[model samples]
Target: MERKYLYLDYLTCIGCETCETVCDFIHDGSPHIRIYVTENKQYLPINCKHCDDAPCVRVCPTHAIYRDEDGAVRIHEDKCIGCLACLQVCPYGVPFYSLKVRAITKCDMCADRREEGLEPACALMCPAEAIQYGPLVMVLELVNERRAKNIPEHRRELGEEELRKSVSSGYVLL
Candidate 1:
């Protein structure tokens, strides 16, 4: 069965990269995070999206990637062949080759934390209230609200060609 998945809010993010740092701190006790922050003009922190139809699940040759009942993708490190095939096909680009493990690793959505009914480490540690973990409907509603607030008034709505674009980017495994 498919349940809700975690995601991030790029607009609320201040590009502090705290999410990345926090994940690293919790997982490795170092400054190395699975998630990365890419900031040019906007503060976009890149992380595993845990997609509805994850490519990683499909592309794993050893069947290392599998979805739980709640639709969370988990990597079976033991089953991984370390062929880097998942890295090639993942649209979100979450999987990566970990030299330490000699296998692929990606965001598990803080599975241990979730088991305790807590939010993902990065989501809980977001100081800006940027990262939200909830149902898709709720998040989309929040995004729409933010868009309404950000757009200027006294400007006549333009055609489809004039619609402003939202922050758009995906993860990249490296």
Candidate 2:
């Protein structure tokens, strides 16, 4: 199945929480998106990866968690017993027990809005154009293009030794 995912450009994000605000507004004032700013000012917006073999789905005793047609991992509120098995197993820590709903809640990629051909709230609201939604291949292409253009000039100035160290440490210097 061709599935869409959210891709973020850490270089472009300005740490603005417009994405968080819009998500909160969509989810009754409880934000599902989290933005983490690194010491180097890289803005990392964390959300559910919606893994194909989602641990959340596997751990749910009630079978409340399931993947939708678009490959979005979703929770059926009616079946959720709130045992938190899904929360415990999710690697991303995306699932949260909602006291109001008495169930587990997480990002569904705004499935309802997507049904109407709308982008996820975060992508639609990001002012920096840092967030994109599409098939994985397309998104990764964009990510690579942006990273190639935005390699910090300071890294390039650090000479071959630092450049090799950075690359070895999993920093995408290119």
Candidate 3:
């Protein structure tokens, strides 16, 4: 199945909380998305990658976390036991224990809205058009394009090999 993933353009993001706000609203006041501001002032929105080899799914003793047909890692709230295993194993730290429900909650990529053919609320509310959702290949292409175009000025100081390593490692080059 062709799955949709979120792509955030740090270069284009203005540190506005619109994505976080919209996500909070969608998830009953808990924002699954988080924004990090770099020392250079770039805003990086971090969320679940929904990895194919999701460690969260593997570590869930109660089988609460499972991947859906669309490849999204979903949490079965009723099945969650609040063990926090998913929180510890997820590489991106996307999963969090919801105190309100005393269960685990994470981004489902707006699965409910997607089923209705609507984009994720965060993507729709992004004022700078920094958030995108689509097939992984297309999203990566956009990331590469924006990264290439936005290569920070400080990266010019790096050696050739260093620059290559930086780009390959997804560093914004600055």
Candidate 4:
């Protein structure tokens, strides 16, 4: 199973909250949102990292969270005890309680849609192209290309290096 990752460009985020709308659309049946967008002076969207060393998988009391063959961290809702252990262990705080199902849920990286070569709902609907999906290596290269060209000389206090590093880390985790 190939690993997949998501990339984000904070500078491009319009803070429109469209990602939140699309998340609800994708999970309309259960109305679950494993991914969501929020603003803190800047548009910020959060989602499950599906960590290479997933804390959720380790902490699930019932073995309810496991990575599929394709490398997606998925929840077996039927086995869930509603313990919320995964919710507690996740460092990124991405998972959310599903009131409709009485279970915990988080992003599966749009695994089903990705298998069909379609983009995740948020990535597709983001009007500013702030969100992206692809192989991690490819996305990193693209990000580097953009960074080299656009960062201005006077904005160094924003710390391009630190910002780039943080964003890259976020991509790998997502």
RMSD vs true structure, all candidates:
6.0, 3.7, 4.6, 6.0
lDDT of 1 by residue, 39-72 (tens): 5555566767778777878877789988866667
Weakest ten-residue segment in model 4 by summed lDDT: 29-38
Rate residue 108 of model 4 by lDDT: 79
TM-score of each: 0.76, 0.79, 0.76, 0.73
Q: What lDDT score is found at residue 17 in candidate 3? A: 80
The residue ranges of model 3 lying beyond 4 angstroms of the native Cα positions read 36-44, 150-174
Instruction: Give the clash count for each candidate.
Output: 0, 0, 0, 0
User: Over the stretch 4-107, how does candidate 3's per-residue lDDT look in tens digits?
Assistant: 77777766777888898889888777888987777987667788878878899898999999888777789999999899988898877788888988898888
TM-score of candidate 2 on Cα atoms, chains taken together: 0.79
Error of 3 at 106 (Å): 0.9
**lDDT of all predictions, in order shown?**
0.69, 0.81, 0.81, 0.70
Q: Which has the greatest TM-score?
A: 2
Q: What does candidate 2's lDDT look like per residue over 82-145, in tens digits?
A: 8988777877778888898999888888998989988799988899888888898888898887
Which of candidates 1 and 2 reaches a greater lDDT? 2
**lDDT accuracy of residue 11 in candidate 2:** 60
Candidate 1, superposed: residue stretches over 4 Å from native = 29-43, 152-174
* Model 1: lDDT of residue 137: 80
* lDDT at position 92, candidate 1: 61
